[model samples]
Target: MTASVVLKFPVFTVTEFRPLDRQIPKNHPSNSVKTYLPLKTPRFPRQVKARTTLMEAAQSGSSVNTSTNASMKLLFVEMGVGYDQHGQDITAAAMRACRDAISSNSIPAFRRGSIPGVTFGQMKLQIKLGVPHSLQQSLDIRRVKSVFPYGEIVKFEVVDGGMICSSGVLVEEMGDKNDDCYIVNAAVYVGY
Candidate 1:
């Protein structure tokens, strides 16, 4: 018995009908031949054009306008995740997340005059937090703001995210109201 297989593509189609139990004889002309097909046009015309444009722009050092303030150019972004296993404090988790994000980083570009016309005093930061929906009200924005030692907070947004799961054990002395553990994610965008 033999089976037929058909493959369809935007540029071409292929149909193969071969024996299931036996291979084609080695002496057959089809067994020793190969075919190469040339494409008349690109399969993804827009993608090819866009990629070339992006490469040219990048090579020319052209910056893209992303921030609302045209003067503010994004330097880098730091991300971190924190969780409160013992206590059900969302703010504590958020603070820890922020700390974790910036702890390992030391950015001296502003003070060192790495960026032309920019100074440490002009540094701006945008903080985005992910917290559970139910615990959004309990999050202390002021306390979270205090985590940053410097930088002017230009934008702050809180979206419904993060997770609440069991910590496996609840200790009354540790202020665990329940066995629920609160997790928070933080993204700090640094720009000037």
Candidate 2:
């Protein structure tokens, strides 16, 4: 038979047991072990309002003035990176990356309060792409530009970069099929 004893501390309580064959005093150091655990709180993000500014038309020649012949200086930047597996399509991977970058952001930069007389279609988008050397020529610029629906002046610039990994697999069981993996990087700039 065994007997159990309970010990109380300022932070925690402990329960210990001993065999009936041994008689050890409760005050002994080996008889009890005390432990204390701390609880942690979680953190969250806070939203902040976007800043606004008013400037003369001569200072910024790109925007058209609406009220008082003055222009509103509006600027916003958001960036993201993405990856695609199995599809050796460079353009498709780049499009996915671009989509990932802008998908989470909701920017109404053309509103009258920010940029007066500036419409959504007037905004210029510069899309820079980094692709593998082997797939540089295969990347379709037209398809890349199609990713942006509202920008008036959307341009795509492809540079020699990114990586290619060997998948050790063939497509359709063909000997000449492309079995290597392809990666593409994208950076989209939105402004007037």
Q: Per-residue alpha-carbon lDDT of model 2 for 87-161, expressed as tens digits?
A: 577777777877877898876656544677677657776677778877888877787777776765445577787
Candidate no. 1 TM-score: 0.71
lDDT of each residue in 1-192, candidate 1, tens digit only: 987777677868767666677777789765442334654564764554434343364457776655334565677789999899987999999999999999999989988999888889999989899999999999999999999999999888888999999999999999989999999999998887
The TM-score, computed over Cα atoms with residue i paired to residue i, of candidate 2 is 0.53
Q: Which stretches of candidate 1 lie over 4 Å from their true place?
A: 1-71
Distance from true location, Cα of 90 in model 2, Å: 1.1
Write down the lDDT that model 2 would get: 0.65
lDDT of each: 0.84, 0.65
> Model 2: runs farther than 4 Å from truth?
1-74, 111-113, 167-178
